[model samples]
Target: MEPIKILVVDNEEDQRRLIGIILTKFGYSVKTVSSAEAALKDMDSTNYQLIITDLIMPEMDGTELCERIKRKRPEAKVYALTGRVELYDDHKLEKFGFDGIIQKPISMNSLKETIESAVENIRRL
Candidate 1:
């Protein structure tokens, strides 16, 4: 079986590395990038099964990034990893092309479940 490939995009180096480490420990193939621009460039060459991006970032925000990604890869599973979940409702998130939102201050257990569920859904497709 192939490992799930994930791309995590965050301006904060600590946040990026933390997610990468956690996903790696979860037995996922993870890649981390510092900026949305960098993430877009990386996507040009690679297709990740899952993309977790910070809502707030320099230059391009997660919503915009997800929108652009979806335009390119409509099947891409792009999600928001933000703390301010209250600011954006499901309608807004969906309109921006995000498949779902993952709240920040992440819980390892939930993260694992989320990823597993997503992978399962992908497999079904």
Candidate 2:
């Protein structure tokens, strides 16, 4: 079976490393980027099955990144990852059309399940 390819975006190096470790353990191919701009540059060069990014970053927050990703690759699942519960509310994610979300300090199991469910839905679409 082919590994699921995921692009993980976070300004914090430690957080990005943790997510990468979890995803890699699940046998998925993961790429880590420090900024939304870096993620966009990589998107132009490579294809990804899903993109998991932080809601609050230095610039070009996750919502904008999600919008751009959806515009460029509508089929790819977009996830908003953050510790802030506020980002999950206000119906902003739905309005932005995010496929799913994973909270920050995410556990390996939770991350795996979220990714699996998101990928399944994308496959169905």
Q: TM-score for all predictions?
A: 0.96, 0.92
**Candidate-wise lDDT, in order:** 0.89, 0.87
Q: Write the per-residue lDDT of candidate 2 for residues 21-113, one digit (tens) a residue.
A: 988887889999999999999999888988999999987999999999999998888888989966487477968868777887787788888
Q: Least lDDT summed over 10 consecutive residues: which range in candidate 2?
A: 85-94
Best by TM-score: 1
Off by over 4 Å in 1: none
Which tens-of-lDDT digit does each residue in 1-125 have in candidate 1?
A: 88878999999888889889999998989999999999999999987989999999988999899988998889889889998989988799998988888888888887888888888887777
Worst 10 residues of 1 by lDDT: 116-125
Report model 2's TM-score to 2 decimal places: 0.92
Instruction: Give per-residue lDDT, candidate 2, residue 112.
Output: 84
